[model samples]
Each structure stands twice: as C-alpha cells, then as structure tokens.
Target: MKLKRYLWIAVCLIALAVSMLPAYSEDFFQHHREFRRFLQHHTGFQVSTLGALNVGVYEAAATLAELKSHGDFGLGTFEGLDGEMVVLDGKFYQIKSDGVAYPVKDNSKTPFSAVTFFRQERSLRLTGRMNYQELRSQIDEQLPTSNLPYAIRLKGTFPSLKVRSVPKQTPPYSPLGEVISQQQVVFELQNVQGTLVGFRLPQYLKDVNAAGYHFHFITSDRHKGGHLLDGAFLNPVVDIETLRDWQIMLPSNTAFEEASLE
Candidate 1:
C-alpha cells in the first residue's frame, strides 16, 4: 500500500510538471504578452458592439503592429453566437442591428464612454478575463476576407464579367506557387441595350485577403460617366472586418455583379 501510494504521488508530480511544460504555456503567454505590449504602446482603443443576436465586440487594444493584427481581438459569451459586446479603454460601444461597429457617433465624436453608452441598457458587463481562442475564432468568422468565394461576388451591370483563366504567376517566395492560376476579368459600362461606354480591368491586384486573394480593377475612362458605371464593379476592400461597419465602401475586395444607380 505504501509503494502504491508513492507511485500515485509520483505520477501526479509528473503530470503537474508536464502541464507546466513550455509548449502548453507558450501560446498562451505569447498572446498575453503581445496583448500587453499592444495595450502598453497603443492606449487609444475604442470598445464597440459587433453583432445583433450573437454580439461580439472588439477593443482596438493596440495599433497595427502588423496589419494582420487588425484581424485579431474579440469578446464572446457563447459558442457559435456572435459576441456583440466589446469593451476597450473602459468605453462601451453598443452593437446595432446592422453588424457594424459604431463608436457612439453622437453629439461629438468623443470616443464612446462606458458610462454613457451603457447607461440606457440593462445588460451587465462580462466577468472574467478575455478568451483568445473563442475571440479569435469569432473574429475570423466575421472577416469577409477569410470566406472568399461568397465574400467576393461580381454584381452590377458587370455581373457577367468575363473571367478568362490565365497562367499563374510565380512569386519569389513560393515554391509551388505556380500551381495557382489567375483570371483576367474585364468590365465595361454600357447602356440598357449594352452600349459600350468604357472598359477597365487591371493586370493585377495586391493582397485581397478573403482567405488568400487580391483584386484590382482598372477603369478606362474616369473623366466621363464611366466612373458611375465602370466604377460599379470596383471596391476598396473585399474583407468586411478590416473596415468600419458603416464604411462608405466595403473593404478592397468587394466586386459587383452589375451596375445600378441604387
């Protein structure tokens, strides 16, 4: 009995040591450290509500240490439910129904205050520390950049824009990059009967980032009404997460299916 008890104690010690090993703790510490560093350097974070039913909100926690870092940061309460609440710098930004982050753009753009924003609401503040995995997963889901095909669509007068698949380009960094090919799409502004006003399609687009894609559309004649029609197919960004919810234009990757004044 003495030997068995000693063996059990030894096993517990080993398990405890393994649990404290570097690998298990590394990711946690890494994220925590980065978050701390970000908060230290960038004190100008705003808290905002992100969703409607499943509210997930974000606090800018830090400036762009890396642009990709913009994709990080989220607060969630339930699984698969959008975390609509976000607290940053002690300010509260309520999530509206449109799934856009509004910084309490009232009176003066005085960066929302926790007291003012939540004054009228009956919801209580979240307890405990932020959860990174839950937050990260929620954030990733909201980024239109990650979910490309549906995230990016060509609608408008040019919904039927011709896409001719071409040979892929070889990036200096990629070994099998040659496997991926590109499509050359052309958009032209025409009348109701299909009268050509102008056409534009760029040779390349920089980083698209829906999952891993970039897009660029060239306009042939901007000086004329071409901008109204030809510009219909163009967008500033494809990923929705990178932009403020009420952004005038979607992120750089949004393409149009057809053009209309609406």
Candidate 2:
C-alpha cells in the first residue's frame, strides 16, 4: 500500500513538471534568439570622412590598432594620403606608390578608412567574364534593397586587374583629386589570384562617404595590389556582409576642426 502511494505521488510530480515545461521552453528559445542576434550584429565603422579627404585633411584620425578594434576588413589610406590601405581577415596591408603591399604596423595611423566585421549574409556564384562595371551591375541586381550599407568580399583569380596607389603627402596637402592625378602609380596585373575588399554605401552618405562601390585589391600572396581601378572576375564567388549600421570616428585633431567640410 505504501509503495503504491509513493508511485502515485511520483507520477503526479512528473505530470506537474511536464505541464510547466511549455512556458519554460518558450522563454529558453526567446533568450537563445536574443543571444544569436547579439552575435550577428555586424557594423561598418570608419575613421574620418571623404569630405575631410576632399578638403586635404590628411591627418591621422585614428591609429591602425584602434581601427582594427572595430572590425577585421576594410580599406583606407595612411597618414598624409600615403599609399592605399587594405585591411583583410584582420591583417592590414599598405600598398605604396611603388605597388608593393607591405604589412602595416599597429602604431601606424590612417587618414581615411572604413571597416566591418564581415559575416556573409548573401553570396553569389558568378560565371563567365565579368568586368568591374558588369560585376557591379550583377551585384546590384542581387541586392534586396539599396537603402542600407554592405561590405563585400571576393577571393579568386582575376583575369585582369588595374590598380593605383598614391605617394605620401607633406603639410599643405593638395586636394585628393589633384594628388591622385599627379602622383598616383598605376599597376596592371594579369591572371592574378587575390582578394578584394570594399563597401557599397547609400546615396544618403554622400558627404560622409562615397555613394557607390569603392574597392581595394591585394594579391593572394598578399604582396601586391592597390586601389582597384578595374578588374575582370571570372567564375568568382562574391560574398556580401550586411551591416546593421555604420559609424564614423572623427578626428580629435585640429585639421578636422579647421577644415571646411561640405
């Protein structure tokens, strides 16, 4: 009789526990989703602005190490418009006018740069020969919307690539256009395997950032590349990292304060 009573109580306890589980399970899944969203919060971050560069504000807005703290992938120029900056897979490269991609020191600073912790939200497996313009168009068609910013990456052998890098500047810097026209060193590579890093910003970011695609290239060997002027991608797999938002870290220095930014 005692054993039967104990068994009855044990069954009752389990039935009560099972009846309470639905509420607990709902809360558990809700918290799990919140944690996953936290992990997936990718953002595009930048130091300085295109407006500042346009006005020749080529001062170190932030150190490379500080920039890396925000994200692992990006592109920008060193202090004084020195060369071109390409940050890929948490590694920073400086492609100087001589067309050499050198590893950047952490203490080095940048005048302008944009970076994001890349996590591919969408990917496209492209085919046939696609030049820069065609590649942009194809990506545009794949985009769900143009209102948001995106970080893009492509790694493969490029049939043709034309890139350029600018020499370092001194005080009394000239406008970016004039400097590029005067001292930009152009390099053309054939059948080069490498990675490309860049961003697609919205038109609303005009003065703060470029309104369209801007990319920088580095060879697969991580030795040579620069501002991607043109390129032909064949059967390339492109990855797009959707950003939750974008942020710009302005210079605390006087150049940014004194310069007239439009």
Using lDDT as the measure, which candidate wins?
Answer: 2
lDDT of 1 by residue, 1-262 (tens): 9999999999999999998898878989999999865543322122221111111111122222221122222121111121122332232232222323333322211111111111111112222322323323443445444312211211123222221111222222121122212222223433211111111111221111112322222112211111121222222112121211210111121111121213
lDDT for predicted candidate 1 compared with the true structure: 0.25
lDDT (10s digit) by residue, model 2, range 27-116: 999999997565445788889899999989999989988988888998999999999999999999999999999998999999899998
Candidate 2 residues lying further than 4 Å off, grouped into runs, are 1-41
TM-score of each: 0.17, 0.86
Model 1 is weakest, by summed lDDT over 10 consecutive residues, at: 111-120
